[model samples]
Target chain A: MTGIPQEQNDLAYDVFAKACPSRGTLEHVTGRWGGLTLGALHQGSLRFNELRRRVDGVSEKMLSQTLHALERDGLVHREAQPTNPPRVDYELTPLGRRVTERLLALIQCVEGSMDDVLASRAAYDAGQRS
Target chain B: MTGIPQEQNDLAYDVFAKACPSRGTLEHVTGRWGGLTLGALHQGSLRFNELRRRVDGVSEKMLSQTLHALERDGLVHREAQPTNPPRVDYELTPLGRRVTERLLALIQCVEGSMDDVLASRAAYDAGQRS
Candidate 1:
């Protein structure tokens, strides 16, 4: 078929030209801690400590930042209980679930082919050395 | 059904516990400039200058760094010709193509649902204001 029709082209341009808010969404979702947080939350609703445990190396400050960004973006729902200990739980919204599912699929793809990627790196390094 | 069986659990733990090389690969492919570079290379082979143009807002140093990382990972092949100005072209290897295709799919998904993300952010901000 031919290229995208004129109206479709205009619509596509609008996304890039208008500095669409999705750019912010992307920055939030793909930020350093954001990816790991979403990945961890995909398993289930997690309390602060649980999320901190799962995302191995993330510092408390970074984790808090990431959660705030995701919360602001409406991808994550944070609920605080007025209990003795003041417990808080984080879970995915419907939109968050959709995004996390996609993120999980991408992670799985990466995990599945990680062996090939390693081998490729080794060979590339060998070639460079010679 | 119950949770993953013992063997599966052990296998899953192996991925994270070993400090796998995939960590570096992830860093390379997902770096600031790396994502955009891979997305552009998915289209076809591009000269250095051509790539520089497509990835908007990328500085020369960042682009160079990204290309080097991809090349080192064997996800990009750089062919430098013996010519007056030292003509060079960048293209994805078979491995690179596979990775780029996946990246492109992710980008399309992000682009496709951008409107919902924007609306979500707006609603979230309104809630914060009230």
Candidate 2:
């Protein structure tokens, strides 16, 4: 836990605060495309189309936007190579790797709980019909 | 790491897959309001309005929708008590708690990294202008 004093902590970026800049970064990290993008990059660096394939369904536009936001936030590093037809690769920065470690844990947790989640959804739906 | 066989794992729900149900649940858990809502409930059970306040900027409609998604997914338990004005409270289910444990780790990581994130933003912006 953070040992920072309560008053100092209050001044720190609190995601629960509506106006905090951290909220924006959190959204970028956990956003629909962002999480998937980062998760894909965690394996290794990837080119644009390769990332699109690994993420499965991100459009070129959304992936580009997601990458720009992440790169701006310093969670992702984009390297554009000058070669035949050009090659741009995306990889997680040190900070991004740390964030993704936690994120992948959360992702795997949810993946592991899918059975329970499905059952719960079924029960909830059945209750609604009765 | 999951020891499941690679062949069997391919059949399992994968967030990276375009059509996996786990992807939907992931979206719900990490959605704009979902993460904040679950994070708030991690403290203890809270009434609807209290959740709204704790999450800082959620509108009533969004909060209601977020809770329903979470409840249906079995990450949140919603209790409607019989009392004056009809009390309703929200709390995390066991599975929810598990998910939130990982989530709060990610959230705290983001919160703690705000200084670096801010500095990164400044450097990124300056580079853009140069």
lDDT of 1 by residue, A14-115 (tens): 212226555566666666568778888888999999988888777899889899889877789999989988999999988788777776655555555565
Report the Cα lDDT for residue B65, model 1.
87
> DockQ score of candidate 2?
0.56
Native-referenced DockQ of model 1:
0.30
Q: Which pairs clash inside model 2? A: none
Instruction: Please provide, for model 2 over B11-121, each residue's C-alpha lDDT reduced to its tens digit, 9 standing for 90 to 100.
Output: 587999989999999999998899999999999999998889899989999999999999999999999999988999899999999999999999988988877788899
Q: Per-candidate TM vs. native?
A: 0.83, 0.92
Docking class of 2: medium
- lDDT per residue as tens, model 2, A6-88: 45654687889999998999999999899999999999999999999898988999999999999999999999899999999
Backbone clashes in model 1, listed as residue pairs: none
CA deviation > 4 Å runs, candidate 2: A1-11, B1-11
- lDDT score for residue A55 of model 1: 80
